[model samples]
Target: MTETARTRYFLLAILLIALAAAWPELSQPGLLNTRGGGDSPFLLQRLQQLETAVLDGHFPVRWMPDANYGYGYPFYNFYAPLSIYITFLFRLIGFSFVRSIHLSHLLGYFVAGWGMFLLARRWFAHGGAGNGWAGLLAAAAYTVAPFHLVNVYVRGDSLAEFWAMAFYPLVILAADGLFGGGRRGVALFGLAYAGLILSHNISALIFSPFLLLYLLLRMRFLTKKQENYPQACTEQSRSISQITQIGFFKSYKNLRNLCNLRIANPIFGFLLALALAAWFFVPALAEQSLAQLDAVTSGYFYYSNHFLGTADQPLIQSTFFVDYGVVDREAFRMGLVQTAVSAAGL
Candidate 1:
């Protein structure tokens, strides 16, 4: 709300947008070129298909009629097409296809940082004396994170995956809001979870358990806080303790009693996500046998080589071509600064 806070956010956004295009494609308008530069090649065509589907009044828009050598491909049926659909919306607003692609990615980067800033704000500033500089640090760190850069620039893996991962923080933010015992974030959690699912099914699958775990952890914290508030308040006989609960944890009174907490907020959020994403996953699952899903269990996905490695051992040594002749093997790194800070925090 303050001018200083606005300035922090503006500066962070500018830095993130600049980072999105720092690579500078050799022969494309977007950040990444289409000359075998990850998935950029087919993304525009998908955009075109989405636009045609809209014009033809197809409700769900499953089949890509122009794909598969004129026989058509069921692209949208299995692959979540929300990101392409966003590009289509950009198309509707009179931007050229290339411009839409550029804007969509730039928006993804900006929104990702914005969401991180909000989460950081709540984390470092909630119920305490804090400043936006902490949020700026968090937002900037997230925006420049290496793996995220891979998703947006290097690998350009899937636009859907990028957006799915980008919005993941907002899901946690909503959960955090709910943990404080209010309906403030129920709708946001629902919509964000649904959109994440529709953005990329595999990512949704990967992120779902963590979301559940975070909800459970928050719930436990809330319950403990509420149950102990009375006892802590009754301790008026002693001086206020400071150093006993860690620097941040030294302030338990900040969380308050959370007396209005209902155990149903997270349940409602889960139900809403399921309801919204059922339209996509219901068919994706029920019709699984009809597709070549059996292939997922074999070949590259065979269990023998997929074991989670121990601390002394490295896991998978996988690599993917990110550009015409450029292969990226270290796409999974979280960056040195992030890794150090995260470990310190833990």
Candidate 2:
């Protein structure tokens, strides 16, 4: 197929997957039931409050006056606010609170699928390794991946994290472009990384190392050096001093090549992302100690104590049945079909 036809076909597939994934919410417009227990209602309230605050000249939107029974709480100041901001925009464009939340969730799936397609296309197209079909399959596999469905259906209230997850592929693709010598790639990387950070701080923190490692792997080709001396060069063929001098020159040339724009661009992108997200992260870091941050990680919620395998539930049972409560511990198995397809791809 022509490039335009291929692009359109992939987009159509992404849209269909998005629609299917969000059918439950779309089918029942006013239904706001979620596995988040009371958290969903509180999130809705917070979004409404944030909208009002911004409209009423709250610049940073740090404090929520109605929270804590009107004593006020600095929730948004430390919390990731991009998802809420998107919901606010949806509300501004005449969507109801419930509809806005559902739409945001739906949009996350679409963006993630599209981003995965972009990355896979680039990966397969590199050195003519594969074709558009590979990218399409990848996009389908990622969109229908069980973890994404679980996030939307189970942890619906945590839209920020879901949004952050959606941006992961975009960040990878943009980083790939930056390392591949695309001039606009640095700006794209900065924007995507900033979006990921603004969506969820923890996801950004976890994914940053992976992004750096990917850049490092890609830079290897650029930094690799050819051995000027032959492998069979015996002591008789070349003097020790001459061999040392040749090795030194090769090393210096490799070092000089490594110092070029390809290596520097990705680093610049990372710095730019930090600069873009400074408004949220700077104050959040500065004032974190003042808040009851410990309370968040204390008691039953302690990270170290709640390992995944602690539960006695069987994998088969957990895989199919959706837990009504404690959705975090819900069956996390990607469906058999998805797993098989993924393995086939591998």
Question: For each candidate, how many residue pairs have backbone atoms clashing (under 3 Å)?
Answer: 0, 0
What is the C-alpha lDDT profile of model 2 across 17-66, one tens digit per residue? 88888888778866456664535676688788898788889977988878
For residues 144-174, what per-residue lDDT tens digits would candidate 1 score against the true structure?
6665666656655468878886778888887
Task: Point out where model 1 deviates above 4 Å.
Answer: 1-31, 34-38, 126-129, 180-182, 227-262, 296-298, 301-328, 334-346
Q: Model-by-model lDDT, in order?
A: 0.66, 0.73
Tell me how far the alpha carbon of residue 189 in candidate 2 is from the true structure, in angstroms, after superposition. 0.7
Candidate 2: regions farther than 4 A off: 36-38, 126-130, 180-183, 225-258, 302-328, 335-340
**Evaluated with lDDT, which candidate comes out highest?**
2
